[model samples]
Target: MEKYGVEVQEKKQVKEEGLQELPGTHENIVLRFAPNPSGPLHIGHSRAAVPNAEYVKRHNGKLILRIEDTDPKRVYEDAYEMIPEDLKWLGINPDEIVYQSDRFDIYYDHARQLIEKGAAYMCTCDGAAFKELKDNCKACPCRDNSVEKNLELWDKFDTMDAGEAVLRVKTDINHKNPAIRDWVAMRLVDETHPRLGNKYRIYPMMNFSVSVDDHLMGMTHVLRGKDHLANSEKQKYLYDHMGWDLPEFIHYGRLKMEDIALSTSKALEGIENGTYSGWDDPRLGTLRAVARRGIDPRTIYNLITEIGVKMADSAISWKKIYGLNRNLLEPIANRYFFVEDPQLIEVKNYEGGKVIVERPLHADHMDRGNRLLPFDGSAYLAKSDIADGVFRLMDAVNVDIKGDEITYNSTSFEDARDLKARIIQWVPAEDNVNVTIVMDDASLKTGLGEAALSDLNVGDIVQFERVGFARLDEIKDNELVFYYAHK
Candidate 1:
């Protein structure tokens, strides 16, 4: 499975997934995961963050967790704490944590240096007018502003009103990419920053702050998406003007995940309007959301490692994740019976009195012990599983179902096998615990679980026999709440 010097994951039963080697050789490989404070990390973010952390681990280098909070209007105050928490749950621990919002002075210093070198200037042109000039490959009148005047405006930048002036980096006006034509380095954001408040108004743009910090932090290698190719080019100009060496930039393709909501803004809107429960709502692709559904952090690690750093775009489905997660959960997760939309079946002609059948919690690991299921001539079968045919009540007895009447046929598992009867999951008719499963689509599936489920505590991952895997989220006074993961 090796490709382009990257270690490939073997096809079957590998202990751990492998990652491809980074492009260049280096004594110190410094990488960073810079997430914006606009929202918590989603599934799309892990495509960039996990590889950086894994590469650092493989090279024995430093990994930095930088929170990009330059945009005050987009910043969600709570994400300042939530981002790191999510990373911790994913088993990613950074060597250093940095906040772009905390380094305003650093950015201001670099902005001044760019002006002194005539690499940047203050542009006071109207937005629409500047775009027309830029589109026509013509330099603005402010492009030739004296360094002294630009520095003077820089000193008075904070006092200026929003959109009054902007500091622009000098680039080729005739460049093929219109976006590269003298991009804005600093702007006046009138809104109050979530962290620093109204202490400052002049904030460096994303490229300016990112470029400055990436160099100052001694990053040796940078992992980015192909969409950021233009951004990388834009940043190199900043490095060139500063007389600093550029870090090796590795760009991968866009990762598109189907049937999952990855937009933090939309998720927040949904939460505000009562359309979603919270950030951990099952419908979202947030790490917390996946974690709530019994998805192991190792599963996420394996997924990214297997995908590696390919240059081509990757499209994935939730089924791929469920398949990987099931392998990790199968041997460890204990099994139990849960009957959704239960139908009562009275077992006639049964001679047994208060039959209690003990089944192994896990078939492969009998040493872990067994769960007891008591049947008192009455049991519940899922209504969907009940048809006009013979079926086996799991480890109990074989029965024939003929138009609402269930009669005991035999007790031998062999007889049920010979009759080709379907092995169906069942819960005792009495003392079954009420259960509510929060499906991945955020729909609720209410059902009855075996009485033995009462002994389990929250945060436990278990299989619901014929049903799929689920994480016990909460235990109410009369019911257990679980979030469905996958089949």
Candidate 2:
């Protein structure tokens, strides 16, 4: 009754109720998101996570969060801690958490079992000699070694230096895909792991480790990039040798985002050289960056769901993602007047110079209430929003400009909404709040916002009328600093 190496989960029969029955979700599917902790969780990683979580929910299945942190050289302490936080931010909570490093002994046990079964053998062949042999489709001489001797060398991995010996799973040396031929099952790594810190020497490569873990953890289905199609075939060989059921492998296309760095190494280097502010830099495609830009988690979830489990590569356009996000935010984000690169406009020849303009928080959603924008004859408008003849200060008032003379039109709100007037965002020049927008490329756009914006709490996402969607990051010195999500 063991479940994922621990508590037993009661399996429920899956009920099909959807558009298309996926390849591997016919039963009590146990899916997982195995992320190597060498970097933060990027959007590419979420492509695996959010959809799998939906499968577990829809199919009454269990989901495992397996941290594949066996590669010591590239592992980072920050990455190890940051990954789960990012997943939680994406609304993913695993039913079980498995750390590969914590189960070194378990992987060792399976490796030894494969050796005893003659499915794997230890190779002491010199690197150059073995490469030539493998290149020529010839088995290493060590492949024919006796079981007792193979086990002996396997145990002596501790006494041997890093490259002196390795354990190779026995496969057809003439395998069609050369990369899958005689893959390394276990090898001595001389480096210390960030977590384990020299606790073990011999380590299993990704293929053997993932194959073994998936089987041992009772994984019923696997959704991954087609780049691992070869690896999946190699693992199938191992599964066949071990007399195990092959998990349903639903391959998917690559999710490529243009002009966004997803490589952990490249991002780290950028951060090191001050090219990026941090992992949450707006330029990155990491979940932290996406979240910082105020894109909703549901935006990512829905996007991946649309991608589904297809076996083709997809280069998702930034415009598509932003467009999707804008759709979600427009309905909920409260509207504000943000004047960018302000141009001063004075209303003259008026009966009373001051007017308190009342605008709805959302034009379509008057139920949410309104904001009080007071203009004492002086207001600021966007330099681009200014035209020579006529315009309306959105929800505020209508003014007619003729030869440096601005004449205040009727102050009736209904007339302004009906005149077919060119409506533009405006703020009182004297009492406006300082608004600083952090754009996607990390540049700052400083402007004036209606003083009503001062009431917004941090983390409140709003749309500046005619500007774009932005998330308030912080409030300081009577100014609101926001991260621009999208227009």
lDDT of 1 by residue, 27-112 (tens): 78899999988888888888988999998988799999999999998899999899999899889999999999999999999999
Top-lDDT structure, candidate number: 1
Which digits, one per residue and each the tens of the lDDT, describe model 2 over residues 180-250? 88888898897989889988888889998999999999999998889899989889889987889999987
Worst window of 10 by summed lDDT in candidate 2: 10-19
Q: Which residue runs of candidate 1 sit more than 4 Å off their true CA positions?
A: 1-18
- What are the root-mean-square deviations of the candidates from the true structure over C-alphas? 4.1, 6.3
Return the lDDT, model 1, position 98. 98
TM-score, candidate 1, is: 0.94
TM-score of every prediction relative to native:
0.94, 0.92
Best by the TM-score measure: 1
